[model samples]
Target: MMTKLRKIILIPALTIVSLSGFFSCGVDRWPEYAHQTALDTWILDIMQQNYLWYQELPSYDDVNLFVEPASFLSKVKSKQDSYSFVDSVMATPLPTYGFDYSLVRNPDIDTAYNALITYVIPGSPAAQAGLERGDWIMKVDTSYISKKYETYLLQGTKAVELTLGEWKEVEIEDEEDGNEGGDGEDEGPTMEYRVVPIDEPVEMPAARIVEDNPVHKYEIIESPVKNIKVGYLMYNSFTAGTKAEPEKYNNELRSVSQKFKEAGVQAVILDLRYNEGGSMDCVQLLGTILTSADRLGEPMAYLEYNDKNTDKDATILFGTDREINLDLHSLIAITSGTTMGAPEMLIRSLFLEDVYPIATVGSSTKGQNVATEQFINEEFLWSVNPVVCTVYNSQHDTYGAISPATDLKVSETTIDGSTNYSEFLPFGTFDKDGKSERLLKIAIGVLDGTYPPKDDKTPEESATQTHFKVEKSVSSPASRRFSSKGLRL
Candidate 1:
């Protein structure tokens, strides 16, 4: 790789005078490795050109660039940056079982545990195998799962067969039924109810490279408010399709807008509770859809880069007449700790517009007010994602961990020997029993104020939120990347 090129210093006097070897002119004539691996050099060159905190980076000559590319990147990155990292070029979407899980101990056995499914990627192997967000894996292959073997759960490039289990309410005859052996004060046939696992084995195929459709689900829902409808969208990621077809997912978002327009929805429910983030273009485009038509062509958001890349700093505008724009009054975002980056940016952009109130339903979002650009070197088979710029709304306003109008902590788990089946419900407009998830129910309640099923207790009292207590996690690397890819441009 070093044989590929050369570096010409424009200012020889400066290089000779200053032993520091600082590129005062900041200009490189050609490809230069300078005793460093081509990968590491490329990483540094890209970071110098785009990193938002490039001024804080150590000089190229001062840093050890001969180390591994990932290590070199770590050494050079600014101390404030935590989202920037290096990975294989396949980080766009890696092969996987397509599900993330938490390891919980088995109540019956101290050593044994189960992998509780947290979220499954749509159209992935886990979803195809009839696995869901609330399912459990009691055993992997023939061995019962325990914390010791948790690292091997759904990992590597091999096929895995899992034994499934679910919590069910079962009746058991009580031994102490108030009967004193023929004294006979029997309280009928005493039975104790307990929620225990009904184990069933399931065969899961090997991992495969699966493309995720960030637009998980979209539909027009009849609102609890009389004669009004709401546009509901469950967006998982902000991905703009693959490198070859960048417009694929963006086009799908436009189609969603068209449907919402046709439905004449008065309010919108944007479900981004699981969305981690994606490209800036998708964020701007979706912002256009949610914003009132009058706000079109105005500044949606802008990027602030380091001093060296000020020329690259640009403001993203709302879509024009060519793009789909909704005339809705307000939007309710379903967000959680998983929601970050572009999704949060979109919410703030709309809120700053003041066209209408933008209310959030779930918990606060993951604070990521910065954007990253992926630098993929096909020859080196490496991709470097460095924080390139800070993102702000049109008003130059930005925040961390966007708070919700109605704060609710929601999660899923299966605790055997307990009676809690509420978390086992599916995520959709409505479950099999035609019931909305807690988040959705609360979002609707925020809009119409007729939620919580009109129970005797107040809406606040009736609305109970619970979270999963995860002792360990068996989350796949692919799942982590999907949710951790912050705002991208």
Candidate 2:
């Protein structure tokens, strides 16, 4: 392969390789030699022909021959392509330890950090372990959870021994007498670290918890000050199901939309803060569901393929939905760094189709304008989610990440490291449900003038606010990019 490639003078544009040899019958269907180098060569060949930015590939001289196929693929693609990568569809989305978390840089000590418990999946190990939202994980298995590289062990570890921390109020020290500070005002609570006993041993194992309810929440909230009723949908992903039929997943979206319409929803708040994108088919359907009948059959996005597959270019139009013209027109979409792929597409499509302006709040989205094509080795055992095409809205806008109309400092943030954090209370929390969920309240406040509206910021501007990039993977898994085709229950 090297000799043939050198003969052809391999360059950045020489990404296309003859893939006819990949197909055959029975055992021969697979490549005969089947070495790691051969596999990587095959991947490179396919990518050159299919990757949206084929011309951006590294030159043959720059290719690292010793790296693994997946790692090599990462190196070959453009630095701008954050979403394109290889991974397995088989690895379970269920956390090994049955807990999901996010790590934030500790502000007090810049060298340290904290892993705040984001969600304790209902029956997951974290929940069963008595771990709740807002718990700051100070250490896992005696390894301090700091900005240090070793802290990543928590995500890959099967069993985690945790040293937890909770916020507790502290009295301020006065400058003169060391009592209550100069003013009488009390200082805020601080994070005191300790270990908490779980139902199981200190260590938790990887397992699937109660799987349904990925749709964390869908509630009709009534305004406290005004006589307006609002709908809020916390859509995590656009999956139809993990193993169930796509129809079942579609029904889940339908059910939520139906309830929102029946509840006489005046304005809607669509939350896609943590979503890492999913199926384009689902995106098309969601665009239809969110849009009104007046815009039915209109183009939401145009999917264009590479030069070799231009025939696959398509115009995805908004389909008709049951709740055609509900009082919901323009909506308030709460987004974050993880807001990407299909969710980003949905927001951009809706905004382009003029169904309504999706007033995005929070951070800028994961700027992934490209979609992956599901491919596999001849044996079908190894799958590859390779970037194959680009998507543009009706107006031919290829926005990598949809910027928020208003920038809001509402996401969880650590102030002075272990001292304070903006703990994100879940939707529908008693006193903090509607106007309480940090990001959601910003949307309502801006609309109703309860809070002053800040100037709309660009993606670059909003990105400066966050140290961590909102994404799904803590690190590359055995085989995973970010999104796997699934039905979101």
Candidate 3:
């Protein structure tokens, strides 16, 4: 849906500089106007008028506005709200290891844990050191993984030594199996895998700013079925572009869709397993690319603001990017719990008028059907991106969590008969040896009508399944932060 930036609500400048003028005298130069109270007052004023849950806001008298803006906003915010937040406009971006990791307790060693590399950005130090998604980190510096070292993986910008390891399955014959001659069981006990450390430690350089392109990878895949070409796009974020080139990434998306159309792609798969969400402008652009021309001018989705700001409520309509629009009946969205905010809105919008359906695969989404507008006080170097409205598809439906049409939460079996979780493969490739990276494979299956395998669990049964356990997960700062970017309009 093409939705333009409708308005910019400029709060009266109540920043430190403005207050500084009010406290001009030497005797009482730092008066009430220059205190945290004024800043908090400014924040409250905006939230009360624009926040989606304005009615649930705490009374002004009950909040301790003397506290820092972050803490003060937290105190006054509605308990139901999790996406609203205040950020320092002058804050520097956090340097990162460029790889996400999840910690899992080592069943073989009591209280010991291992870090599983979740995903590594290309050209990052982790990739330079030859780390892949399935790799493991057994120790951090000299400390083995324990409660004390559980959070070491998240120490952004810190130089650290990582002891690499591998997950291996060792067959342990059951003492009661009695294969020698007694009543031997038909099969051995379930196989188990253990993490074994490598001999040398990897010297991980200090975290640095790694340039990540939201348009990670795109390709035209030739399906096994004759006369069918599938477009696979692994999109990690919804960012439009940098300040210098606002439409840079959006232009790239247009190029990819044009390529797909030229290649006669019959189906498209959007892999958003790691996307946490970003600008709604990009969402509208991508939605337009996937929708059919006949669907153009239809309501893709709409934002519902609080009563005080009902005038801001707007519907995003599907528009044509004539050169690239695919006009497909349906498309696939590969999602995980990390997919949220604008990405969720994009997924819901695909169901526009029920004329086009989105076949979502993988795990449940993060369920953030809300959009935020950033209010910046540039003079004071502060900004607040508060959730201004709840988003809904044309059908007026908002999901608690967007469950996948197919779920791939089942565990893999090791050679020793124990269960081990499968790891993500590099984008676009399927594991012929095993079922790892099943999300993309299943999506491809849907296009070929071979999905669900006729033997696999139904979507309903799979929805109740739980992912394999990990002690803790650590994604890049952007992946963990909500409303990191805002929908401009």
Candidate 4:
């Protein structure tokens, strides 16, 4: 009986294996193998086609005909020592520099435009003329408000008159009453006030950075909305210092989160606008901390092949093992075109797991959801270009889903450097004529619990009951019941 049972099980297992093998074999051929062979053949063909005089000479081993030892020796002796040459080049001192902090512009508001301030250094001549921020910059010297004038004004060195609002050229001098009031006690410096709108723009100092200087720098900006604080940490790139590790990234994020919690911050906005992606390990560590326990072991994404080639083609990927229990009070992760690689993964993970609803206000994402491993030929040091290790979000369902969750599109009309949040809200993609202001109003109404939800009755239920015809825009994408928005219930 046992022998029969074993035979029965083994026969079915073998049959299934055979079927799987047959099915897999029927799939298309591996593209990488074909690609590599084609590339090699093309290279050889090109080399043969463009045979130079150098190739006409005998091989290196054919010393009898090709070798010129005397000439080669002479050439070597004529050149400087390689070690000495390299050392001399490396020994040169680097230039010293510093950054000017006089002028400040809101990065979100002024995308690429660097609006200059005409404020000179404290000891500089521009400061002597007096220039400050918020002064309505009319013109530099002789240039008017035109584009050419703006450019010319920027080029000018002389002082420019800035019209100050209301309080200008006002100074209050203290008068001492020496006989009765100031006779008993020594009166210190009295209160003095001065309001002067200097005509010239300030010539700010040049910006620079020291080679290996160690200086702690940080910025604290209070959020316009109540109970929200934004802390922006800008690092040039992740591969900066030698000792920088995964813990460094984790510690920084944890410290910021702790501070936010202490400050009673309702929401934390992690501004990674300038952060070019670094170590994947570091990104994983961060994700672990930001994510919750329920989502710890869950598959963040799968990395599989498009073709049914081999078992090695499949890979099940997951976020780091580290898990944080703390509530991730809404994460406002700011991203731009520059954000790529691991940064993109970080943003995607945040959205996928519902850790924090992402609101990408600026621009679209740089869609590079693939990781690769490089192999170099040891003898020639010629690298076989990156072998794709894993394709991200390979589940096929969420491959091209890197768009923003809120759908709050940002443009020039919505953004300004002023504190008017209302202005920002009342302007989005809803108004094609630039006058409708419908989307913003709708958003505001929704937020205020005033926008009524659309009634979506089923066909079967409607058929049973008395139905009335409803006039709706048929052209709108949102009209379909099972639309992309999934808002219709």
| Runs with alpha carbons beyond 4 Å of true place in candidate 2 | 1-36, 55-66, 89-95, 103-114, 138-164, 172-213, 323-327, 352-355, 378-380, 406-411, 414-423, 430-435, 453-489
Q: Write the per-residue lDDT of candidate 1 for residues 350-379, one digit (tens) a residue.
A: 884445788777678888899887778777
Better of 1 and 4 by lDDT: 1
Per-residue lDDT of model 2, residues 1-489, tens digit only: 012111121113223433455565533534443453455666677777888788888766567544544567777887777666554334344334444566665544555556666655556656666776666576667666654454355655465676676543333333455664458665543324222323322555544424534566778877655657787887766766545564666678778778877888787788887677777767777777677567877888888887888988888887766564453577778888767788877877787434466677788887877888756655323445677788887677888667764435345443322323443566544233422556666677755656543454322332113244322224212111234452111
Task: Pick the winner on TM-score between candidates 1 and 2.
Answer: 1
Task: Quote each prediction's TM-score.
Answer: 0.79, 0.72, 0.81, 0.40
TM-score of 3: 0.81
lDDT of all predictions: 0.70, 0.61, 0.71, 0.34
Model 1 alpha-carbon miss at residue 301, Å: 0.7
Poorest stretch of ten by lDDT in candidate 1: 1-10
Sorted on TM-score, best first, the list reads 3, 1, 2, 4
Give each model's clash number.
0, 17, 7, 10
Number of colliding residue pairs in model 2: 17
The lDDT, on a scale of 0 to 1, for candidate 1 is: 0.70
Model 1 misplaced stretches (Cα beyond 4 Å): 1-38, 91-93, 156-160, 170-195, 225-227, 406-421, 429-434, 451-468, 474-489
Stretches off by above 4 angstroms in model 4 are: 1-250, 264-266, 302-326, 353-356, 372-387, 394-398, 405-407, 412-489
**Model 2, 262: alpha-carbon shift in Å?**
1.8
Error of 2 at 467 (Å): 14
Candidate 3 lDDT over 174-290, as tens digits, reads 565435765645654455456778779888777776667788889787655444888999998887876667778889999998899988997889988888788877888888888
